[model samples]
Target: MTDCGCDKAKAELVEYLHNELARDDASDIREHMAGCADCSSEFHVNVVMTETVQRACRETAPEELRVQVLARLRDLQASHG
Candidate 1:
């Protein structure tokens, strides 16, 4: 991620790009991205990653891989509990 001028603003921009911000706060972040080059580039990278994940999700994931992951998660949860 490009280091924007302010840490807080950069964090807000990340949340905004990920659609994790509240409606009222997101508008301000959107405006900041429009005016900031660093923020704009960071947002563009996030957009690309999001699109890549969405496209990848269309392909089938291995069932055995999913089962192994779930089994590990259950084991971890049980150990923690």
Candidate 2:
């Protein structure tokens, strides 16, 4: 496989992280990161950020807020309908 340089690696990093890249493309990025510290650092930061955001999104809203929002949505729908 060809060695994809820093630009391609950085550009495809998100896709690589999300498992959206094809096998060969992913391999190219992995190979690039193995040798390139900057790209590897950026990938590490992205992984942390992605995990933090995912954890934050997993939190549920307060029950009171959930009920209120649902009620408001129903009211708006009833009015519109």
Candidate 3:
């Protein structure tokens, strides 16, 4: 199999994906990815997924769901009282 820079990037892949790599290492990874199609594709997927999850987490629960939860809590408190 042809080397696709995967071996070189593997050690720091997780860190790179998570934006935890140091400045120099991250720059090096970017440079390496520019020349490596496979690595670039994988990086793009990782970044997209990470951003998607982060965006999802930032969303508030539906108002109906929040109301339901609060109603359940009130019921439990009333029963105990």
lDDT by residue (39-58, candidate 2, tens digit) is 99999999999999999999
Poorest lDDT segment (10 consecutive residues) of candidate 2: 1-10
Global CA lDDT computed for model 1: 0.75
What is the Å distance of residue 28 in model 1 from its true position? 1.1
* Candidate 3, 1-81: lDDT as tens digits: 233367767667778888888877788887888888878888788888888999999999999999999999999999999
Off by over 4 Å in 3: 1-4, 69-81
Model 3, position 59, has a per-residue lDDT of 95
lDDT of 3 at 7: 77
RMSD of each: 6.9, 2.6, 4.6
Cα lDDT listed for each candidate: 0.75, 0.98, 0.81
lDDT of 1 by residue, 25-59 (tens): 77766666778877778878888998898899899
Q: In candidate 3, list every pair of residues with a backbone clash.
A: none
Model 2, residue 68: distance off in Å is 8.8
